[model samples]
Target chain A: MSLIDSISRPRAVRLPRIDGLIQWIVPLAIIAIWQLASVTGFVPTRVLPAPSDVVLSGWKLLLSGELVRNIWVSFWRASIGFLIGGSIGFAFGLANGLSQLSAKLTDTTLQMVRNVPHLALIPLVILWFGIDESAKLFLVALGVFFPIYLNTLHGIRTVDPQLIEMGRIYGMTDGELFRRVIFPGALPSIFVGIRFALGIMWLTLIVAETIAASSGLGYMAMQAREFMLIDVVVLSILIYALLGKLADSASRVLERLTLSWHPAFQKR
Target chain B: MQTALRTALPETELASQANFAPHARVVREERLAQTSGLPLTIRGLRKSFGDNEVLRGIDLHIPAGQFVAIVGKSGCGKSTLLRLIAGLDKIDAGSISFGQDVKPEDIRVMFQEPRLLPWARVLANVEVGLGRDRASQDADARAERALTEVGLADKRHQWPSVLSGGQKQRVALARALVSRPRVLALDEPLGALDALTRISMQRLLERVWRDQGFTAILVTHDVAEAVALADRVLVIEEGRIAHDVVVHAGRPRARGSVELAGLESSILSHLLSADDRT
Candidate 1:
C-alpha cells in the first residue's frame, strides 16, 4: 500500500458545485478578509473593527432586544406605506390605461411628476407632516408610488386589444374581463412594479430614518458613526443589507408562485 | 371585377346553387338559417386611418345562416370586414344591425390565435364564453361536450401552455362553440396550423359546422382552403366583393382530388392575377 501510494499520486481534492459553494464561500471570504485587515492594521481597528467585534456588538444588541424593537418600527413604517402607495398606483394606472380621456389628461402630468425625485420633496414633507413617523412614512410612500403606477400603466396599456375583443364577444362582462383577462395579463408587470416599489421603500426609509429617527437600523448607523463605534456601524449596515435581501427574496418567491403560468417561470 | 374563373363556372350551376341551397349557399348562410331569419345587414361600411382608406363604401348583407368566406390578400380589408361584422371595431360610415333585438352575447368570434388565458384550464377557458348565471353545472357539462366535439374532453384540466398549437386552436373553437352563439365568426382560425394539422382541422370544422349549424364567416389568405371549405368564397378587393365563387363539390370533400385541385388552382390564379394587378 505504501509503495502504491508513492508510485501513484492521490486524486486532487474536489470542489463543491458553484451554487452549493456560493452559500458559504461569500460570507467566509468577507469575514476572513475583514479579520485579516483588522489584524494587519491595513484598516485601523478604531476606524474599522474586526469581524468578531462587530458580531459581538450585534449579539449584544439582539439580546438586549433594542435591535428587534427598532427593526419592527422600521418594518411597520415601510409596510403601511408600501400598501397605500402600491394600491393607489395600481388603481390609477389601470384607470388611466383603460380610458382614453383619462390617459390623455393624466399621462403628461404623471410623467412630469415622475421626473422630480421623491427626495426633493423632503423639506416640504417635513413641513407638512413634521418630524414624526408620518413624514418618514409619507416620504417612503411617495417614493414607492411612481414606479408602481408607471409600470402598471405600461402593463395595462400593452395588453393585446384582440384579447379584449375576444373577451367581449365571449359574453364576458366588464368585471369578468378585468378579473380574467386584464388583471392576469398585467400581472407580470405588476410584479415589476412591486419590485421597483420595494427598492424605493428601502431608499426612502433609510433617508428619512437617518434625518429624523430616534430608532431604526439607519439611525443606529448614524449614531454609531458619530461616536466612532466602527464595529457597531458596520453591524447596522449589515442588518440593512440583510433586511433588504430578505424582503426582495420574499417578493420573488411570491412572484414565482403567483405567475407560474408566465412563460419565464413555467416548469419544463 | 368579374374574373375568368367566375365566367368559367357554369352560370346555371351558380344560379342553381344560389337558389336551391340558399341556406347553404355561403359559409355563414347555414348558420343564419339556424337563427331563422337573422337580419345581419350592413350598408356602406367605410373605415379609414388618416388618409389611407382600409375599407371604402363596402356593402354586404349577411342573411341568417349564411356561411360566407371573405378572401383577400394582405391589406385587402378581409380582417377589417370580419372585425366590423364582429363589432370589435366601429365602421366610419356604415350601420350593422343583427336583427332588431339581438344582444352582444349572441355573437361569438374565434380569432386566429387561441387567445386563451394561459393561467386558465381548458374547461375554464371554454366556460369563459358563458355568463355567470349561464355558467352552471349544466353549462360545465355543455363545455365538456363542446370539448368532446373538439376531441379534447380528456384535456379539461390541462393548461393552455401544455397543449399543442392545434389543441389550443381546438380549445378556442370549443370556447366559441360552447356559447351556442347565433353568429360564429372565424378569422383564419387555422391559418397558423401546419399542413397536416390544417387538413384535420378543416375536417373538424366541417363536422362541427354540420352538427352545430351555426353561422360562420371565415377570413382566409389561402384561396385553396377557401375553395375547399367555404360554400361561396367572396373575394374582397379594394374594400368590395370582387368575385363570389360557389364550390358545388358538396360536404365531406375528398382531400387532394382532381376536382378539388382544379378549383384550388382556379382560385389561386385569381388571387395571383389580383396581386399582379395591384
Candidate 2:
C-alpha cells in the first residue's frame, strides 16, 4: 500500500464517528433528567418549570398568537436598528480606512465613545427620547455600532501591503485599487463584525424591551413573571435562544457563499 | 581558467572582454534597431532608508527587448534598483528615462510572491492586470490568452490558494504579461520555488520573454540563473555594479554546461572577493 493510504486508512477506524441521531442523545438525556426531577418533586415547579410545562405554555401562547406577535415586534426592532447602525459603521470605517486625515480626526473620539457601555445609557436615553420606540431603537443602534466599526477598521488596516503595492504597480487607478484590493481584502473581517453586531442587536433589544417596551420577547417574559407564569417565561427565553441561533446560521450561510475562495471554507 | 585568460590577454582587453560577448553585442544592436519597445536609461540613481544608503549613484543603459539579470547578495539593493525602474519607489537622486514608446502604464513588476487576490479566481486575478479598463470587449479574451501562454488556461476557475507554488508563480507571470507591458521588472520572481520548479519557471520565463519581446529586468541572487537567462549578467556589490559578464551561449542554452559552470564560478568568486573587501 502507498504511504498516504497506510497513514490515513486506520485513523478513521480509531476515532468513532459522531453523526445522525446519536448527536441528539445528550440533549434527550438532559430533558429526561429534568422531567424526572420535576415529577419526583425534587425541584419546585413555581421556581423552575418542567420541560413539558414549558412546551404546554408555548403551545397555548402559539394558539393565542401572543408569542408570534411579540416575536414579530422584536424582529422588526432589531432589523431597523441593525440597518441604521451597520450602515453608519460601514461608512465611517471605509472613510477612516482610506484616508489618514479622516482617521486622525475621528478615530480617537470614536474609540473613547465606544468604551462607554450602551446599556449604561439606558437612563440617559429615556430622559432624552422617553420610554418610546425612539429610545429602544437608539439603544439597539448604539449597541450594534462599535463592533462593526472597530472590526471594519481593523480589517482595512491589516490588509497585506504587498497586495496593495502589486495593485498599484499593475496600473490600477485609485478607485479601482479600493474596489478590487482593499474592499475584498477586508470582507472576511467585515463579516466577522456583522455577525458580532447581530448578536449585540438581540441583546440590546432584550434589554430595551425588558426596561420599558410594551411588546417584545423580553416584555412577554416580564409580563409572565408578574403573573407567576414560570413556564411562559421559560418559553420566551427559549424563543430568544432559537432566534439567536437562526440569525447565526443565516450569517454562516452568507459567509460560506461569499468566502468560498477561502481555504478555511474548502471541503476536505 | 582566470589565469590562462589573463596571461593570454592584456588588462584593458580583458576588462572589455569580461563586460559582454561579441554575440550579445550583435543581439543588443539588433534589438536597438527595432523601434517597437522602449530602452531604459538610468544615471546617478540613489536611494536611502533612514541613514543606510541602499543604492549609491548607479548608471546603466538597457536596450529594448534585452533580458538582463542582476545578481547580488542580500541587502545589496538589487531589488531597490528594480523597484525604481518599475516606478514603485522614488529615487533619492538622479534620473530614469524610458523611450517615448514607453508610458507609465507600460511598466509592470512581478513580485517574488504571487500576490494574487485570495478572493478572486484565477481568471479574475489575471483579469486584474487589465486595470480599470476591464469593461473593454477584448479584456476577457486577452486574459485567457495570457493564461494560455503561461500554460494555466485549464486552471482558470481554480482559487489561487489551491495552486502549488510553481503554478501560482505561473499565474503571477500571466498577470504580469497580460497587459503586454513594454518593461517587465521581476523582483526575484522565482525565488520561492523548489529546484525543479525553478528550472521549469526559468524556461517558461525565457520563453515568455522571447515571445513577448519586452525589456526584461530580473533581480536574483542565483548566479547560474543570471547566466542562464540574461543576455548580460550584472553583479551588484555594495550598491553598485561591480562586474558585468555577458553570456555568449545561444538560446536553449544547456543547463550545467562546462562554459556556463565556468562563468558561474567566476561570478561566485567576484561576489566572494567583493564581500571580503566590505
Pick by lDDT: which candidate is best? 2
Give one digit per residue, the lDDT tens place, for model 1 in A60-112: 98999988988898899999999888888888899897889988988888889
For each prediction in turn, the share of the native Cα contacts (below 8 Å between chains A and B) that it retains comes to 0.56, 0.81
TM-score against truth, every candidate: 0.84, 0.91
**Candidate 1, residue B143: lDDT:** 88
State the lDDT at A205 in candidate 2.
91
In model 2, how large is the Cα lDDT of residue A135?
87
The true-versus-predicted C-alpha distance at residue A77 of model 2, in Å, is 1.1
lDDT of 1 at A158: 82
> Candidate 2, which CAPRI tier?
medium
Which residue pairs in model 2 clash with each other? none
True contacts kept of 1: 0.56
